[model samples]
Target: MLPAEFDYAAPASLDEALALLAGGTNIRILAGGQSLLPTLKLRLDRPDLVVDLRKVPELSYIREEDGEIAIGALTTYADLVASDLIDSGVARCLAEAAASVGDLQVRNLGTIGGSLSHADPAADIPAAALALDASLVARSEEGDRTISAGDFFHGLWATALKPSELLREIRFRMPANGGGAYEKLRQAASGFALVGAAAVAEMDGGTIEAMRVALTGVSSGPFRLHALEDRLVGETLSEELVREACDKAGEAIESPLSDAHASAEYRVAMAGVTARRAILRAAGQWR
Candidate 1:
């Protein structure tokens, strides 16, 4: 399908992109264009202008400084998968999720910032973001502000980013201890998650000290299973216990999606299954 005519600008600098965004009321920012381009072609979105950020070199890097790891918004899924920094320890789940997204071509073209900004309910990245307790940095003419991953995702195809804000970077606190893992059931056709779970856990004296479990593809948005986490913490983790705790995975979801690929009930049930697997894997009790 041919897209509606729109003025386009490829900005080499973020400031120029910000200027374009501020100057236009109906404008779209194009990162990898894996998601936005499809919407444009379908005429689901008819922006007056599109500001391409591909030439913005500063927004495509991965760096670790002090106690934080900062990843540019333009960092692609392929970059994440190939990164030694993301392949193990705390950020492993994020890499796992990135590797699971679509195929080789999609991974090469899909940006972490673009994926999170699009906020697709079935996306693989958001669950990892939630588990990692990531922070998103948004830049605008006003300056930079940070948004926690918990507050960043609003609902289906929605995020906290304002029209004038460009997602600059995603930041994660360096993993002091423990490990994390991502687990998902893919939708056969699109490779989107039927139910995706991410879990990060720190153990003490062979018991669960701290843990985070997050799920996507079953709700209006990806969300942390705090209720379940709270229950499992301080308890010696076991297959039986994790299985029991994860039964509450769907209890916190206000709106579970029901689509042709999977029913709400099926998703809710799989939520428990995936969450349990992720939790056990992260805690090092499962392989």
Candidate 2:
């Protein structure tokens, strides 16, 4: 499990990190080393240089701003779980998803930014981010750009982040009055999502006002249940309606990944099941 010999740089500041990245694509950014180390051990990623960001103290905070929550790219899963910001509302789904990542060890070591940037279809964070309609902040020598969570994901193990850029932070508007849930069918060994779903909904007098449903592990990337969410608006919460909407949960998947752990069909089926569970729980607390 030894990685190939490569040059390593642990930059002390974001500017230094950006400078190194500007040098070339052969340089990989290391945040938490949670995903990068595994890829290196597998020899799946070959890089001439590895730039570590752990030493950069600036990119590791979670705070509130103007009715929104700003999450640093370096924030770990354990941080998400412990933050008071996640006790209720839309952020609750993110907290639950973070809590379900691997075990306590992985949660302690894994950064939310690394997990999202890795763009693993089976990973938990992206689904919750999508459900919350978060935006990603990416910085480079050229300038800074804010990308919507919907626009950040491209495909399996892919993201819109340019090689010369570093993801600086993630931001989402705080929900005023709402409820949400994250439900997953977990793989036995890895604890990664076999099929996971996150739902956030707001109610206006027992009728659905705004809602989002995003699914992971059944698609090439996390995505919202657009049609289902649209159908839910103005509709009163009902078991039949919830089931009917969630039945189309896997329809957005373009190309699904299948392995020994679970087949594509099983993932698709469980996506529907978990989505139903998530939306039902979200609906339950809307009152």
Candidate 3:
């Protein structure tokens, strides 16, 4: 089906885009058109105006500054996969997640900002964002504000972004020492994750100094396994300890999603399976 009739504007500057957003109600910002176009075609969202940011060349970039990697809102998944800077540690988790998104076409066009803003429960990036301890910058007519990844996603398809705000950039700090990995079970048809997990582990000698484990596609929103992380910190790194802690992976999920692709019970079980694999891989324990 064709998209509903709407006014369109391709703004070359972010300020211009912000001005357009501030002046209109029922406005949608278009980055890569990966998510929004399909929604528009389905009439799931009919807006008064669609502000396309494709012409805003400044918003598409990847750079590192002051110990953090800053990714522009319009940076494509393909860009992430190709960047040499994102090859290790927490950043690698984000890169791996990007590599796993849909197919080549989607990866080529889908923006990281667009994926996070859409906040789809089955999206691959949110889990990595959570594991990497990312901070998202939201731009509005008023100014810019940074929101932690933990506080960003409110629920299924819902986020902290105000209607007038656009996600401007995503930031991830370089870990002092650690490795990270993303693991997922994809649905056969859509390539959307059935259950995805991202894990980062910082080791001090043989002890686990700190660790983070997050899950997506199993709950209303991607979330960290804080309890599991808390249990592993300061403990001696061992296959047994990581495996045992991961067994409680689904314990914190109060409402696991149930759908035709997989049952709630199956998701709950796979949560542990994916979490274990991700944690082991991040810790360099996986063979």
Worst 10 residues of 2 by lDDT: 278-287
Instruction: Give RMSD (Å) of candidate 2 vs. truth.
Output: 1.7
List model 2 lDDT by residue over 176-223, tens digit each. 767778999999999988899998888777898889999888767788
Residues 1-287 of candidate 3: C-alpha lDDT, one tens digit per residue: 99999999999899999999999679998988989999999999999999999999888899999989999999999999999888777688888899999999999999999999999999999999999889999999999999999999998899999888999999988877888899999999989999999998898888988899999999788999999999999999898998898886887877999899999999999998999999888887886
lDDT of each: 0.91, 0.88, 0.92
Q: Write the per-residue lDDT of candidate 1 for residues 74-168, one digit (tens) a residue.
A: 99999999999888777888999999999899999999999999999989999999999999999999999999999999998999999999999
**Model 1: lDDT of residue 215:** 92
Task: Please count the clashing residue pairs in each candidate, in the order shown.
Answer: 0, 0, 0
Q: Among these predicted structures, which one has the highest TM-score? A: 3
The best candidate in terms of lDDT: 3
- Candidate 3, residue 280: lDDT: 83
TM-score of 2: 0.95
Model 3, which residues run further than 4 Å from truth?
A: none
Question: If the candidates were sorted by their lDDT against the true structure, best first, what order would they fall in?
Answer: 3, 1, 2
Model 2 misplaced regions, further than 4 Å: 285-287
